[model samples]
Each structure stands twice: as structure tokens, then as C-alpha cells.
Target chain A: MPPFSRFTALTEQLPASVPFVGPEVQERQAGTPFMARLGANESGFGPAPSVIAAITEASATVWRYGDSESFDLCSALARRLDLPCEQIIVGEGIDSLLGLTVRLVVETGTPVVTSLGAYPTFNYHVTGYGGRLVTVPYRDDREDLEALRDAVLREDAPLVYLANPDNPMGSWHSADAVTAFARSLPDTTLLVLDEAYGEFAPDGVLPPVSDLAQLPNVLRYRTFSKAHGLAGLRVGYVFGTAETVARFHRVRNHFGVNRLGQVAARAALEDAHWLDHVRAQVAAALQRLAQIAEQNDLQPLPSATNFLAIDCGSAVRARSILEGLNAHRVFIRMPGVAPLDRCIRVSAGPASELDAFEKALPTVLAGLT
Target chain B: MPPFSRFTALTEQLPASVPFVGPEVQERQAGTPFMARLGANESGFGPAPSVIAAITEASATVWRYGDSESFDLCSALARRLDLPCEQIIVGEGIDSLLGLTVRLVVETGTPVVTSLGAYPTFNYHVTGYGGRLVTVPYRDDREDLEALRDAVLREDAPLVYLANPDNPMGSWHSADAVTAFARSLPDTTLLVLDEAYGEFAPDGVLPPVSDLAQLPNVLRYRTFSKAHGLAGLRVGYVFGTAETVARFHRVRNHFGVNRLGQVAARAALEDAHWLDHVRAQVAAALQRLAQIAEQNDLQPLPSATNFLAIDCGSAVRARSILEGLNAHRVFIRMPGVAPLDRCIRVSAGPASELDAFEKALPTVLAGLT
Candidate 1:
């Protein structure tokens, strides 16, 4: 049958495309689970034991809808960040929040600025809302802040996105640089400063929470998926000025965040020692990943996040290596655009999974050669 | 600081109103937990033991993202419903799906039709997308199907929402009647046939899945939240023609459904015996609720779903009874619009919770008198 005839013109014009093809899809196609699942930047380290307990405990109460307000989680987040509860709004994940943010600011033909080949989910939301994308190419495997600012100004873009400790290439800027770039933006331009990888970055890599909390146009997004190791639970939040964050309530799915996510995230927050252990594991895994890339004659890019991007020297080589790894039952991803596409990204995970990737990489590279 | 300057004019114009204040929020304000939690229509019997076990088992893997495709869950649903897997799309919840549906069809000033006291979340989503709502009031305590059809025809609305075994009043239309109403609408008017409470509804209250699965403009929304007792898990799905269902891919949060939710929902769907058990419990609880209302000299409406709406003779009496119930630590709700406001709605729950309500009702009623 023909598709529904009444979908909006924008929806009709849009192509059906997912931002990411999950590793499970590949597993189904291959008819076997990957021996090492590392794709999509999910932490193989998993969540804290306390978080697991919380989720298991919460299992009995799954009949109750999650507090639509996400009250406790937001309050705990506020306390940790030294911000008022009004400054924080918890959501299903950074992806869901990004969708809401785009919906709030984007209208048909509205211009939105972002780095080319950045987080595709942000771009998906922008295009989903019929916003015209203004792309700024990365410079030296890092998002070019100056160029992004230029594009935002040139297009008179009302919305802009920047991910610190960036995805795919795993590149980052100093906190001061991010602060300067954020401060440089016109008040009219709202900045979605995604800090999904902030927990893994060096101390100096993230500005103090208070530094940008007062900025009405800056909403800093963070997730438990990375260092906190709860990707499957889908908990994330954005914090900004009370006035700006409150606007999320005007459009957000109030009960979108699952009950266990709130429970798991709150437990994850309380377990600081577990977070520290995960960070240590991620740091060690990054080194092992770098060594593996070097052993395979690939250049591993410097990373601030819990993943390493190995420069396979060319887009063709990167694609071949990625497919070769997949064929060897090691799941990994790569950047989708030029320049950055020369690299394949591997998320930090447990030693056994990393060992599988380590054991398979040389053979996969040799097969490609 | 002022709110972000880039929020669209529509977003700025919208108020920060949630469809319902969760019991948790009310508990916070009241400084104590409700003795009976029945306000939100969530199942109090809880999910099946197998589902709980699945959640606990899946708790260890909360670091991995849920399969973006929701492959296994969709396949299971398709198998059970005798539909192609491509015809179903699993999402965070019915609420989130409603938001996406509105976004897909409602552009600025687009007309959408629904009953006056229907699901507020749908209205919130429609208004969030700048859709002009054309509401037809309920007739005789049930959604006036004829009036709804007339409104759709009169407004030339692209979208119409009707929840079978509907919320608030817990009234239902026969499957044949619903099928006829759906067939009568213009193919251009997409019908969001919400069957959130379908499992609790009597047999033949829902058309066979195959009957409307072939219709491009008729999307059937079902959830694990109601009878399956997994509201906290936030899993729901929509099924229609493959072509129309595929459109969800263009805008859905690919990994929005949490991993444990996927696990729990799949488990819940498999446990038919558990569903039957819950239905029996709900049936008994509904009768008990009706007895309590009648004992208090209030009239209880006939219901096919898992709730009873007690008519307190007038809107003022209903409001007073609802407030008295709140003061007595018995959580229940009433419809928001006039006429419907004369009814106080109570969900079917465990005997302990209902016993608490049963004990408190007379006292609350006497206090009100």
C-alpha cells in the first residue's frame, strides 16, 4: 500500500535513514554474535554493581510509570553539579534530548550548524524537523570551532551543536577553548554543547559546571553511557540556565526516561568509586587499543574519550579494515565523511573483548593487504 | 537570564504543562506516599515473574545500547500478531510514539481531531507541533464516535486519535464499530487507534490485527504498560502497512527503547498466562472499586478496561471527592474537561491497595459531607 498520504510535506520529503546501524543488525546478518562487541562507543565495562542492584530491585516496580518529573535523578544531578534542580532536565538519553532541543528551536528551513561527520543523531533530528544543515568540515581530525562559528554566522543559524571529546575521531579541545568558543557565539545562537564524553576527558578538558551554567543559550548534555557504563539504561541530562532548561518541559517527553534508568543513574552517581574504576579501565583500554592499531601498522589518533580512532591512512583502507574486523567478529565503527573517514573507531571495553579485537586486528589487516 | 532566543515562536508560545502529574510528584508535595496508587492507570499487579527475571538478568548488560532495530521484540510481536516484522516499530512508549506521530503529520496550524477529554499527551504533542486541535466532547460518558467522525470530516484533519477501551472513563467501543469508524475516515486522515488498554478490554473490543494492518493510514498503538504490567519499562509499538510503518524510521530515536525494556517487554509478551492472571485480578478489582463507589452513594460507570470512573453527580462533587481521596492518601484522578469532570477515575490494582481505598473512602466521603 502507499504510505500514509497525510504525513507532513517535510516527512514525505525525508528519506528513511537511521543515524547509526547497530552492531546487532550486523550480528543478525552474519548469523552470529560478534566475539568482541565494541561498536557505537558503548562501554563494555558495564555499569556499577550498585546500579545493577538498583535495576534488579526496580524490576519489581516496573508496573509503576517513572516519575514524569525524574525528580530524584535531577535533584541528585543538581547536587553533584552544584547547580539548582531547575537547571537540570533528565531525558531518555542525549539522543532524545537532542531531538527535543531541535524541535524547540528548529522550524522549516531554519538553519542549524554542526561539524560535518559529527554525531549523526543531531543531524538526523535537524533534518527530521526540516532544518537546513550547515556543515563545517573538521580540521586535522578535530571539529574546527572557528569554521563552525563562521557557518553559524553565515547562515544566521539559530542552533549549533558541538561535542567535546568528540566522537568517531575521539579528538577534543581544551576546556578554555570550548569556553571561549561558547562565549563567542551570538546570544541569538543556541549552542548544544554535548559533553557525552566529558567524564572520560582530562580534568582540564571540561570547564567547571558553574562556568557555563549561567549561559541561556548553552545547554550542556551529559550521559551515563560512557564512563558511568550504563548505555543500555538510556539516561542523560542537559543543564543550563533555569529559564533555558525549563523550556525543555514545553516539548520533552516528560515520562520518556524509563524508571530503572532513573534508578540506575542515581545509583551510578552515588558510586563514585565505581566511576573512578571505570575511568581507569577506559584509560588502560585506550592504551591497549593504541598498541593494537600500531601492531597492525595503523596510526591511532590521540583520544580524550573512552575510544581510540585508528587512522587507516585512507577512507578506502579504513572501510576495508572496518569490514575485515566485522568479518573477524569484532564490531567497530568509523567516521562517515571525508578526512575523518580515514579512521576506524573502537570503544573501550573489558579485557576479554579487547583481547579478541587484539587477536583479530593483525589478521584482518593482513587480509586487507 | 532570559530564555534561549532561538526557541521557535511556537515553542515560546507553548506552556510547560504535563498531561498528568505523576503520583510520585503528588507524594512529594503531600510529604508522604499514597496508600493506594491508582491515579495514572498503571497496573499495580506488576509484570510477570519471567519478565522481572529477564530484567534482572539483563541488568548486567546495561552498558550496551539496545538494538536500534528492536529486532527480537519486533519479530516476536509480528509472530504473535501474524504480521510482517517490517509492519511494526517499537518505541520508548505510547507517549513517545504519540509525540513522533504528531511530529510526522502536524505542521504549523495543521488540524487534528480527538475527543474533548481524551489523552492529553496526544494533545500536548499536537500542540507542540503547532497542530490546531478540533475536539468533540464525549457523549453519554463514551467518546462520541459519530461526533469524532464529523469533526475529522469537517476540519479535514490529517490526524485523529481514538483510544479503544479509552482512558479516564474506561469506556470501549465494539471492534465492529471501531473498524467501521476507521473505514469511514478519509484515507488521508491517519487514525491513531490507541489500544493501550486493549488486553483488559473484552474480546471483540479490538479488531483482528490483520483487519487494520493493511490500512496505510490506520496505526494501532499497543503497550506493555497496561495489562502486561510493565509501565516502568516504557515499551510500546505501532503496526500498520509496511510502507507506513517504515516512515517511523525517518524520525524515531533508533535506540530510544532501553535495553532492559526490550528484554522485559519480550518476556512479558511471551507470558500469556501472566496476562490472563492480571486480567482476572483487574476484573475483580474493578468490581470491588464499583462496590466502594456505590456504597458511598456515587454512581460507577460501566467499564471494559482496568479502571472505574465514579460519577459524583456533579463536577463540583467529583472535584471534592477527588481532593478528599488525595487528603486521605488514596491517589485517584478525574477527567479535566466539564461533564467528564463529574467522574473520578480509579485504576484496578492489588487487593492491599484497593483495601486501603475501600477503608478510606467512607471516611473521606463523610468528611466531605
Candidate 2:
């Protein structure tokens, strides 16, 4: 039978593809679970014990829908961030928030600027809304701020996405540089400053929340998925000026945030000691990953995030090494675009998972040779 | 300062209002919790113990993202419904699915049809996407199927929404009538047949899953929220022809479903005994609600779902009774539009909650007199 003939022209034009191929899909195809799940940048340390307790307690009340306004969680976040609740909007995840943000600004043929190998989910949302993507290439594995600004100006783009303590490459810029870049962007161009890895970065890497909170054109996105260890809970939030963040309510799925996710994230925020402990563990794991890479004759790039990008000299070698690691039951990822594709990205995990990666690396490298 | 200047024209036109005000928001305003929680149609009996156990067990793995494809849950749903997995797409909730469905079909100024007082979320989504809603009024407290067909034909709408065993009024249409209505619509007009209350409905109320599964334009949306008692988990699925269902992947948040929600939903779906137990309880509660309404000199509408609509003779009396019930800490709701607004809607919950409503009713009615 013919499909529904009336889907929007934009939806009809969209390709039947997803932003990321999930690890579970890969596992199903391979017929075995990866021994070391070092891809996707999920926290291996897991949520704090208090968070687990909160989730367990919340399980009994699963019949009650989550507070559509996300009152308590937003209140807690407001207190922690020194912002008003009106300026914060909690959503299912960064991906959901990105989709909503895209819907707000994008229309057919609207220009959106981003680094060529930036977050695929952001790009997916842009294209899903029929926004014309204008790509900027990475300079030395870091998103080229000047070129991204130039594209925004050249194309009169209304949206731009930048991830700090960048993914896939694990590189970062100084706080001054990021602030300067934000100041340089046209006020009409909304800057989606994604700080998904902010918790793991050094003190100077992230500007104070207050620094950009006044910018109406900026929305900073963060999540518990990375350092706080609740990727499965799917809670994320964006903070901006009250006028800008309040607009999300007009378009968002009001009850989309899960109840246990709110409970777990609130508890996770209160457990500062757990975060510190995980930070230490992540630092140690990053060291172990670097050592593993060096021992196997690969270059480990300096990182401000909880992952290392090991340069394998060329994109072809990186691809082969990634496949070889996968065959040995180690799951790792790489940048999708060239230049940065010369590296394999491995998330920092517990010592045991790192041990699997460490053990498999030499064998995979030797096989590739 | 001003808001971001470049939000799409449709977004600027949308009012910053939500479809439903949650009970939590009400509690915050009243500075006290409601003794009886029945407003949102959530199951007060809660999810099965086995589902809670599954949730607690899955809490430990909250660091890993949920299976993006929702593979196992979709597989189980497909097996239960006798449909192919390719025909199913799981999302955060029915609300999210409805939003995505609207995005797929409704462009700016596109015409959509629905009963005037049906699911407001569906209407919200249509308007959020700039669709012009063409509403048919309820006939004798049920969605006027014949009129709805006429409106669809009149508007040549590309989308229409119908809730069987409907919300707010607790009314339903026979399966044969519903099937005939589906057949009457233009094949180009996609029907969103929401069966959120399907479980509480009688055997003949729902058409066989296979009957509509073969239709390319008929999408059936179901959820774990109503009878399965997992509202806080925010899990819902839609099934249709494989070609039609595949369109959601291009626009959906692939990782939006939380991990424990999937685990909890899978367990809830498997707990048939718990569902049967809840059904019996709901039937008894409905009878009790009818007795309470009759005692208060109000008319109880016959219901096939988990809630009843108690007619108070006029919209003013219904409004007064609803406010009175709220003042007495009995959380019940009334339909938003006229004709339907002559009744106050109350969900069937545990007897204790119903007792609070029964105790409050006489005083509320006396105050109205």
C-alpha cells in the first residue's frame, strides 16, 4: 500500500536515518555485549548511592505522573545555580531540549551554523526542521570559533551550536576564549553552548554560570548523563535569561521528564562527595587510557573531559584500530569527519573496563600491523 | 533585555500556556497536598510490585543510556499485539508521540480535526505546529463520530484525533462504529486512534489490533499510564504500517526513553494478573463513584474507562462543585469546554481516596445550594 501521502514536505524530504547508532544495536548485530563499554561517554562510576536510594523510593509512586512543571527539581537547580526557576527548563535529555530549541528557531531553509563534526543530534534536529546547515571545519581538533562566527555572519544564521570540553576529541578552550566567542556572535544568532562535560573539566575551563546567564541569545545545556552518572535516567536542563528559557514551555512536552529522573538528579546534585570521588576515578582512568595508548604506539591527546582521543596517525589506521578493538569486544568510537577522524575516542570508566581495553589494545594494534 | 529575536513566526504566535495544570502545581498554590489524587486519571493503586522490583533492579545501570531503539520492549509489545517490530515506535509518552505525529503531518496553517473537548494535548500539539484545528462538538457526551467524519470531509484535514473510551467524559463508541468511521475517512487523512484507556475498556470496545494494523494511515497510540499504572515512567508506543511508523525515526529523540522506564514497562506488560486485579478494583470503584454521585443528587455518566463524569445539571454547578471539591482537598477535574463542562470528572482510585471525595461532596453541594 502507498504510505500516508500528506506528511509535511520537509518530513518527506528527511532521510530515514538516526543521529547515532546505539551500542545495543551494535551488540545485537555482533551477537555479544562489548566487554568494555568505553563508547558514548556514559559515566562508568554510575549514580551516587543516595541517587539509587531516591530512584528506588520513587519506584513505588510510578503511577503518579511527573510534575509537568518539574517544580522541585527546577527549584533545586535554581538554588544550586543561583538562578531563578523561571530561567531554567528541565527536559527529557539534552537531545530532547535540542530538538525543542531547533523547533523554536528553525524553518525551511533557515541557516544554522555548527562545526562539521559537532553533535550529530543537534544537526539531526536542524535538518529535521528543514534548516540549511552551514558547516565549519575543526582547527587542530578544536571547533574553530572564528570560522563558526564567520559562517553565522555570512549566512545570517539564527542558530549556532558549540560544545565545550568538546566530544570525540576531548579538547577545550579557556574560559576567556569561550566568553569572547560568545560576545562576538551576533545577538540574533542564538548560541547553544553545550556544556555536557562541564562537570569533569578543570575549574578554569567553564565560565561562571553568571557570566552568560544575562545573555538572551545564549542557552547553556547540561546533563547528569556524563559525570553524574544517570544517562539512563534521561534528565537534562537548559538555563538562560528568563525571557529566553520561558519560551520552551510553549513547545515542550510538559510531562516528558520522568519522575525517577527528577528524584535521582535532585539526589545526585546533593551528593557532592560522590561527584568528587567520581572525578578522581575519571582522572585516574584517563591516565590509564593514555598509558594504554602510548604503550600501543598511539598518541593520546590532552583532554579536559572524561575521555581520551588517541591519535592513530591517520583516518584509515584509526578506523582499522576501532574495528579491531570492536572485534576484541572493546567498544570505542571516533570522529565522523576527517582530520579529527585520525583519533579513536574512549570514555573513562572503572579500572576493570579499562583493564579490558588495556589488555585488548596491544593485540588489536598487533593484528592491524 | 529582550528575548531571542529570531524564534520562528509560529512560535511567536503561540501562547505560553500548557494544556493541563498538574496536581503538584495546584498543591503548591494551595500550600497543602490533596487528600485524594484523582485529577490526572493516574492509577492510585500504582504499578505492580514486580514492576517496582524491575525498576529498583534497573536503577544500578542508570549510567548507561537506554536502548535507543527500545528493542526489547518493542519486541515484547509486537509479540503481544501480533504485529511486526518494524511497525512499532516507542516514545517518552503518548503526548510526545502525538507531538511527533503532528510534526510529521501538520505544517503551518494545515487543517486538523478532533472532537472539541477531546484530548487537549493533541490540540496543543496541532496548534504548536501551526495547524488550524477544526473541532466537532461532542454529541450526547460522546465524540460525534458522524459529525467528525463530516468535519474531516469538509476540511479535507490531513490528520484527525479520536480517543476511544475517551478522556474527561468517560464515553466510548462501539468498535464497529469506530472501524466504519476509520474506513470512511480519506486514506490521505491519517487517523490518530488513541487507545490510552484501552485496558480498562470492555472486550468489544476496541477493534482487533490486526483490523487497523494493515491500514497505512491509522496509527494506534497506547500507554502504560492509565491501567498498567506507570504514569511516572512516561512510556508510550504507536503502531501502524511499517512505512508510516518508520517516519518517526527521522524526527524523534532516539534516546528519550529512560532505562528504568523501559524495564518497568516491560515488567508491567508481563503482569497480567495485576492488570486483572486492577480492572476488578476499577469496576467496583466506578460503582462506588456512581453511588456517591447519586447520593449528592448528581447524575453519573456510564463509563468503560477508569474514570466517571458526574453531571451537576449545569456548567455553573459543575464549576462550583469542582472548586468545592478542590477546597475540600478532593482533587478531581472537569472538562474544559461547554456541554462537557456540565460534568466533573473523577478517576477511580483506592477506596480511601474515594472516601475523601464522598465525604467532601455533601458539604460542597450544600455550599453550592
Candidate 3:
């Protein structure tokens, strides 16, 4: 049968691909569930008991749709961050928010800037909105802020994605460096500062939330997916200047967020002690990951976030190591392109899951050669 | 402190708005929850017990992101529909899917077609994507198939939305008419057949799934929101020719659909008895609603779906009745556009709530007069 022919040329030209083929897909293709799932940067500690209790309690009230304004959650977030509620807008996840921001700024051929090997989902949104992507390669495994700023200025790009305590590599710059980069960007450029992993990052890595509050050009993105451990719940929030944040209402799927997500996220926010505990756990896990890399004669890159990127020397070797880990029922992944692809990225999970990875790594490396 | 200034002109021109302000927002503004939530077409009877059970069961694994592929749910949905898994794609809800479809088909100045008072969410998506909506007014309170076809042919609209057992009016075309409408459209005109309320529609109102299976131009939309009572779960699916469905992956938020939504929807699918019971309840509720309308000296339009649209003589009277009902703590909604706005829409819920409506209708109308 012939396909529907009405899609614009840009959509037709795009490949049928996802930013990441999930680890669950990997398990399915392997025809067995992985014994250790450390590919996705998920907290294996699970949500705090309070969050689960909240979810279970909210289950009876699931007949009602979530608050379209997400007022309570926004108020909580704003209070914690010292911003007014008007500056905060909640959505399904930062990924959905990224897509909305891209849509707002992009028309056909509009230039969008990001790192060469940064988050593919951000790149996907840029292309999905028919924007021209201008990417600068990572300088020393960190998103080269100077190059990105230059590209934005040179191309007059209206959108830029910056992940602090970044994904894949899990590397970061200091708060001052990030603030400087933001201040340097043109007012026309809308910086999507994704802090999905911010809760897991070292304290000093994330600039103070109030630092960017008045800048309409900066949208700081965060999620319950990482440290809060509710990725499956699909809740995230974006906030900045009220003027810019208000624009999200124009295009957001108002009732798109599930009821449980709202319940789980609100509860997660209320449990800051759990956040601290999870942060400590993730820090310990990262240390364990670094030790494992060293024992296996691999170099583990420094990460402010939950995941560790261990350089396996070459992309070919990294691929084999990833496959070997999988063969041993340890699921992990790596970046897609170039120098970054030379390292395998593993998320911090439970101790037993990390033990499985530690045990499997040496054997996987032995089999690799 | 200056704001970002580079949004597309169309986006800048659009108002910051939600298609429908959720009842939760209404409750916040009113400082009290509605006693009856019959406004949003949500199933107050609630999701199957088994579905909530699935949610509580899946709570542990929610720390991880959902399957970007949404494999298991899509496979189950495909099997139920007898389509290849490749031909089925799921999203946060039909709202999100509509946004992606609009992105695929619409550019600035792109002509899209739909009924004058159709699903506001679809129109929101079209406007968000800068599509010029060419609306064909409803005929006899049902979506006008002949006029929509004429509009599509005249403007060569690339995308058209048609919801069966449609919202607000709760009216439908017979399967023969629906099929004829589909068959009448040019292959180039993509049909977004929203069957969000299909589960409650008369059997003959829904075409055999196979009838449109080979028509690449047809994409049938279904949701767990209506009869299944999983609206709060944000699970909706669309199925079409494999080739047409493939395009969603090119632009969709792969992990946008929540894990609980997947689990709940699957469980909802499996609970055939609950669905059957709900449909039966809906049929009875429709009758009760009609009786209430007749008792109130209003005309309840013939309905194929779970809601009743009671014509109150004129638009102003309908608005007054709606406001009066809400003032009495009974939440109900009406279509926003003319001819359609001449009626008030009431969703099917447990009769105890409808009893509140039954009792309040007279008092509300007495004051309206």
C-alpha cells in the first residue's frame, strides 16, 4: 500500500529513528531481560518510600486529570528555587519541553546550535521543527561553550541546548563558567539549559537557580527522572522568565501529563532527605564505577553527574566492550559519534547491579581482544 | 534582563492558552472541587481495578525511563488490532499525537481542515504548527462529512481531523457514511480519524478495522480515556498502514508516553468485562441524561457516544445553564463555537453524580429563565 503523502518534505527527509533505542528494546531484541540495567541514567534506589506511598494513595483518585496549570508543583518548585510560580511551567518531561522550545523559535531553515555529540533528543527536536542545526564538536569531552557561543553568534541561531553536568560524558563546568556562557549568548538565542542530571551533580556545578531567573533567553530544564527516580512517571519542569515560560502554554498538551506523574513528582519534591541520600548513593556508585574501570585498565572520565564515561580507547573497542557486557547480561551503552563514542557510559544503580558490572567488565574486556 | 526575541512570527502572534482549561484549574479558581466531574468526559466509574494494580506493581521499576520503543504495549495493541506492531504507535495521548501529526503536515500557510467546532485540541495543534484551519460547520450537530470533503478538495488540505462519535455534540456518522467519507478523500489528503470516543459509539458507527487498513491515507486514533476510564493515564494509540505510521518515529518523543500509561492501558485492554460494563453504564447514563433534558424542557441530541448534548434553545441560554450548573457545584462543559454552543455537553458517569445533575438541572434552569 502507498503511504500518506501529505507530510512536508522536511519530515519525509528525516530518518525513522529515535534519539536513543531504550535498554528495554535491547533486552527485547536479546530475547531475555538484562540481569543488570545500567545503560539508562536511572536511580535503582527507586523513589523514596514517601513517593511510592503518595503514588499508591493517588491511584484511587486517578479518575481525575492532572492540574493543567500544575499549580501546586510549580509553587513548590518556585519556592525551592526562589522564583515566582509564573516562571515555572511543568510538562511531561524536559524532552517534551525541549521540543516545545524548539518549535517556538524554529521555522524552516532557522539555525539551531548545540554540540556535535550532545543529546540527540535536542537535535531531534531542532530537526523536527525544520531548523538548521549548527553543531560545534566537544572540546575535551565537555560541550565547548566558547565554540557554541561563537556558532550562535555567527549563524544568528535562535536556539541552543546546553546540558550542565552533561549527559553521555557526565562532565561539567563550574557554575561561574556556565553563568559566563549564558551571559555571553545573544539575547536572541534561547538557551535550553538541561539539568536533567543536576540533582546528581556536585553542588557547585549548577549555578544558583535565581542566577538565570530574569533571563528570558535561558530555560533551565530539570526532571524527576534522574535523582528523584521517577523517569517512568514522565514528569519534568521548565522555568525561566515569566514572559518566556508563558509561551509554553500556547503549545503544550495541557492534559498530556498523567495523574500519577503529578502525584509522584510532588511527593518526590517533598522528600529532600531522600534526594540527599540518593545523591550520596550515586556519588558512591560513581566512585565504584571509577574503581572498576581502573582495575580493568580503562580510564574513567570524571563525572559530576550520576553516570561515568570510561574511555575504552577506541569506538571499535568501546562497541565490543558494550556488546560483551550485554552478552554477560549487563546492559550499558555509549555515545553515538567520534571521540565520545570511544568511552562506554554506565549509569549508577544498585550495589548488586554495579557488582555485576564490576565482575563482568574484566571478563568482557578479556573476551574483547 | 531582556527577553528572547526570536520566536517565529506565528508563534509570537498566538495567545498563551490551553484549548480547555482542565476542571482542576476551575476548582482552583473557584476554591472548591466540583461535586460532579462530568465536564471533561472522564469516566468517573474509574479505571479497572486490575489497571491500578498494574500501576502499583510497576512502581518499583519506574525509576528507569520507559521503553522508547513502547514495545510491549504496541505489540499488544497491534495484536488486538490485527496490525503489524510497526503499524501501531502510541504517545502521551491523542493530543500529543495530534501535535506530531500537525508537525508532519503543517508549515506556515499550510491549509488544514476540520469541523468548525471539532476537538479544540486538534485545532490547537494546527495553530501551533502555523497551519491555516479551514473549518466546515457541523451539519445537524454531527461533523459534516460532505462539507469536510469539499473543503479538503477545494483547498487541497493535507490534513483533516474527524472524530467519530465526536466530542461536545456526542453525535456520529454511521459506519457506511464514515467509510464513504474516508473513501471520498484524495489519497494526498491525510485523514486523522479520531476515535477517542469510539468505544462508546454504536457498533455500526465504527467501520470494521480492516476497512481502512489498506488506506495509507487513514490513521485511526483511539484512547483509553473514554470507556476505559484511563484518561488520567495519558495513554492513546494510533494505527495505520506501516508506511504511514513509520513517520511518527521520525518526530515523536519516543519515551514521551509514560510507563504507567503503558501498563494501565494494557491492563485496561485485557479487562474486557470492565469495558463491557462501562459501555452498558454509558448507554444507561445517556438515557438518564436524555430524560433529564426532556424533563427540563430541553432537547437532548441523538448520541452515539458516552455524552449528551442538550440543546437549550439558544447559545446564550446554554451558557447561562452551564454557568448555573457550575455555580451549584456541578461541572459541565459546552462547545465554544456557534450552533454547537447552543447545547451543553454532559459526560456519562455513575448516576449518583448524574443524580446531582438531575436534581440541579431544574434549579439551574429556573434561575436561567
Candidate 3 docking category? medium
Q: Kindly report which residue stretches of model 2 are placed more than 4 angstroms away from their true locations once superposed.
A: none
lDDT of 3 by residue, B161-206 (tens): 9998888798888999989999999999999999998988776999
lDDT tens readout by residue for model 1, A263-298 = 999999999999899999999999999998888788
Q: Rank order by lDDT, top first?
A: 2, 1, 3
Candidate 2 scores an iRMS of 0.8
Instruction: Quantify all predictions' global Cα lDDT against the true fold.
Output: 0.91, 0.93, 0.89
Clashing pairs in 1: none
**Candidate 3: tens digits of C-alpha lDDT, residues A89-135:** 99999888888888888888998998988999998888877789898
What is the DockQ score of candidate 3, to 2 decimals?
Answer: 0.77
RMSD of each: 1.0, 0.8, 1.3
**In candidate 1 chain B, where is summed lDDT lowest over 10 consecutive residues?**
B360-369
Model 1 ranges with Cα > 4 A deviation: none
lDDT, candidate 1, at A148: 96
**What DockQ, between 0 and 1, does each candidate earn?**
0.89, 0.89, 0.77
